[model samples]
Target: MAAGCFYVSCLALGSLGSICLLFTAYWMHAWRGGFAWDKTLHMFNWHPVLMVAGMVVLYGAASLVYRLPQSWVGPKMPWKVLHAALHLAAFILTVLGLFAVFQYHNQQKIANLYSLHSWLGITTVFLFACQWCLGFSVFLLPWASEWLRALLKPFHVFFGASILSLAMASVISGINEKLIFSLKNSTHQYSTLPSEAVFANCTGMLVVVFGLAVLYILLASPWKRPELGILTDRQPLLHDKE
Candidate 1:
């Protein structure tokens, strides 16, 4: 029953994350116009699309690498590598997303990093980078002692989940900020609850739901990765081979 529930939760989490990505992409394409680097507003659209793809969806997926049951029988090194690689990719995309926004602001003569959304977004990225570096050094590197790894493990997991929370909050605020700015002057003002506004609101809600689902999966004791005594016993052999 526990295994079944874990799989079910994983499916739901994947679906929610995919939908959030799609909704963000659709909003940018259908209402805000398609993305392009030369076009400032369109370039701005890439900010949300890439951020949603990288920071929210991909980041959430990476955090679940160890919890998948199919990999329970094998050495965990591969999974660790995969998790780190995914995070590296996500971090790169997130940086590009930030660059797109900054470029847009520069082109438009708009002030940068001046909003609540920007504050949260930049902080999340900074912390996420730090988290990834620390995890890589302690977990993946060869020199770290078991005592140090165990000592840092709790903090690594804590910040992993916390960074996701911060990311979701940043995205939510960004959605609201975009909607307010985009709709304030047009015929379909924000006060009137325009179609774009409605779609964006739905997207934001989906993001929140997805974030909650990820947290639930991470926090559930039943779904946590089991310790691999076999692998631990083979550590000496593995190190000698390395």
Candidate 2:
């Protein structure tokens, strides 16, 4: 029952995060002045959309893979494959997202990586890439010995969470920086919590919810899968009935 509840929670939170991120982007894109990064400035909108989808939403789901019950996620080999695939997808989207913003800055003749947010974001992406490569090489490949896999498992789990934490901080910093810069010329005061400001704040808060939910699920001890010794897809957690 606890496993079932946690699985349900993961589904609900993941859906909520994706919906909020998409809605926020839609609101910004449609309601506001619209998009154009090159000459028009639409490129700016892509940054938030991509990051929320790729990092916050997809990455969160990938991180929660280990926590998912066997009934939902299925056997070990496929589960591991799915986990890696999700991370790869998130990495691709994140790279594209980063490129979008940099392209916009270049087109505008503005300096890039000028803010604390950019520095952190760049660092996070770099670290995430390294982590993914190492995970794929060490865990997925038969190249790694059993002893090595055992030694590295905990580090892989914790470091993934640590990198996720850094990514969330970078995302928040990004939202704040973007909002401040965009609103700087507004006749409507941000201090007054105007429509746009309110939307931005709400979006940020939704992202925070997503991050917290993911971290909680990942850390919950009860959700961890039983270690498969020799049998690849066996569920040892479920006791055989007498």
Candidate 3:
């Protein structure tokens, strides 16, 4: 019952996070007004929308591959495949989101990768690509040598958690930078909580909440998925060479 509740809470927070991002993008930014690279500033809005949805939310879901109790209830192949596939989709969306930003910057003549957020964002994306490429070529294969998979598994999981943290940090920094740069007024800036500022702050907080919930479930002791059937031992937190 508790595990079920945790899973439910994960989904609940995930939904709330998505709503926060969507509200900021649609209502706060007025994205529907126009979406074009040419002076329709709204086009840049999709960059945040897609990145939040892809890198943060979908990636979070994919990271819960083993945490999903349903995964342990059945053959691991389907769950493994789903994990890789969802990560692939998230990676593609992230690329598109990054491309949108680069295109917008080029069209608007804004300097690229000139901010901390951009630097972190680029590094996170590159790391994600490397992680995916290695995982796809190794673990996803039917004939992976068991010792090799076991040897690399610990690094794989560790790096996965680290990459997610980096992605989250980049997002928070990006949100802060955007609010600071865009929220302009002699009388009131982000501190005063204009409607956009309020929404953006809430959006950032929502993502943070989502990250905590997902990570807690991933790392918590009792919540860890138990092996099925003959393998009754809990998996080691880190793989040890035999």
Candidate 2 accuracy as TM-score: 0.89
Q: Each candidate's TM vs. the true structure?
A: 0.92, 0.89, 0.87
Per-candidate alpha-carbon RMSD to the true structure: 5.9, 3.5, 5.2
What lDDT tens digits, residue by residue, belong to model 1 across residues 103-161? Answer: 98999999988889999999999999999999899899889999999899999999999
Residue 135 shift from truth in candidate 1, angstroms: 0.9
In terms of lDDT, model 1 sits at 0.88
**Candidate 2 local lDDT, 13-131, one digit each (tens):** 96888776786687568645556656436876787788878877889889887765553444577777889999999999898888888887788888988789989888889989988
Question: What shift in Å separates residue 188 of candidate 1 from its native position after superposition?
Answer: 2.0
Clash number for model 3? Answer: 0
- Candidate 3 per-residue lDDT, tens place, 71-136, comes to 666677888899999999999989988888888888889899999999999998999999998898
- Scored by lDDT, the top model is 1
Error of 3 at 18 (Å): 2.6
Rank by lDDT, highest first: 1, 2, 3
What alpha-carbon RMSD in Å does predicted model 2 have with respect to the real structure? Answer: 3.5
